[model samples]
Target chain A: MASPGPHSRFSARVGGTPASISEAAGQVMAIAEAHGYDKAARFAVRLAVEEALTNALRHGHKGLDPGTPVALDVEMLPDAMRIVVEDQGPGFDPAGVPDPTLDENLNRPCGRGLMLIRAYMTEVRHNQRGNRIEMTYQRPAP
Target chain B: MPSPESRLRVSQDAGVTLVEFVDRNILDEANIQQIGEEISGIIETRPQPRLLISFANVDHLSSAALGTLITINNKVRNKGGQLRLANIDPQIYDVFVITRLNKLFNIHADTSAAMSSFQ
Candidate 1:
């Protein structure tokens, strides 16, 4: 099979609730499979999406309502699948996020989300505001 | 009694608290929090708990869940307890390796191996 084509693209505005995130993530995963994404690629996409949306609710909208909505867009190409998760909150600095791998932070229970995203995804970028994250998952050759 | 929504299936084997996940994807926030609390409660019940978490059923995991595991690890350490993780699928194992958590955790290839390492 070829890469994930444009015809397989979809977008959803999902809340932070478990049901909402599961449904949205399921849809993207199914589409990815239809486009011939392997288990590893599908796994990466799912983790990145969950972490991005969860970050929006937990960090970006900390004091805000948990039900506040965020945008999740998945676009597929022959070579890569791009996902964007944007939240409606004051953005922070991505560079300021301390390295989770540091010896001091190894026991820290949080902050590894962003690091995982950066590690798994072929590419990860945060907007100037830092509330929006765009990630690209490069599909491995068949 | 564990809550109806309990995400873990826990049992006792040779003085060890063996735990497994009920869900395939341990990625949800509320569920992760509940699992953390439940495991934490188990850790508190023993003077020095020996916890062995198996990932046989878990297919997807988020960093939040990793945090929960770390928190559990810390609690186990503070209580003079021990913790072991096993049966992680290849994909999920890669996640631990990338986050450098593999270095921080005592991981085994299977339940038997982890169980044996407890002493």
Candidate 2:
């Protein structure tokens, strides 16, 4: 399959280790910053990316070996940012996550990451396998 | 590179343990783990365990850090104490709001305000 577009694109295979996952987030933020994204915008993208990667490491690679790889692909468009995070692990249903905002679930920590990603990004889509997700954000007009 | 302990400054006032974090911009895994350990230390060592986390210098934090905060909060609650947060950047504050954690914790404008809440 051909790559996303003519715009700037970055791809990496991040190690499943905690430190490497964080490092990948840093690289994604740097790329967003270099593309003229402001602080808040960059932060939103960074948080979403980190959350997605963390989910992959925590859920996708749960019972597997420690060094499984998580794939990251970012495409910077003229007015948007697109990111894809793919993990090689057992896929699960994201919709099954409990509602963290509810009073009963308020104290639980399980669903906050996905909530934040959805709140920050313009669109969040998961593949049928649930091991991959694509998130996009439209840049604020200058 | 400043050690996570150095980057996270802890002080005490009026029975409240105040934690001040200095993250140039983001709180990655290392800082989150360090702060998590520090919070655990506070729970273990402090007699009453009242905590007020200050984010005056932090720009952003990952979800893992948020999980750490939730864990810390639960620990404090288990001890029949409280955990509050103060001086958070507006953008960072939005994260709390989006996650609905702003309602779960006692958040204030500054450290002094948060301190007064403990009384």
Cα RMSDs, all models: 3.0, 3.4
Question: Candidate 2 on A32-94: residue-level lDDT in tens?
Answer: 777788988988898898889988888888998888888899988889999999999978898
lDDT of 1 at B40: 92
TM-score of chain A of each: 0.92, 0.92
DockQ, model 2, C-alpha based:
0.64
Clashing pairs in 1: none
How far does residue B46 in candidate 1 sit from its true spot (Å)?
A: 0.5
Model 1 scores a TM of 0.94
Error of 1 at A111 (Å): 0.4
| Candidate number with greatest lDDT | 1
Which residue window of length 10 is worst by lDDT in model 2 chain A? A1-10
Most DockQ-accurate candidate: 1
lDDT of 1 by residue, A1-142 (tens): 1223336578888886877887788888888888888888888888888888888877898887878888888888888999999999898899999999988989998898888889889999888988899999998777
Model 1 CAPRI rating: high
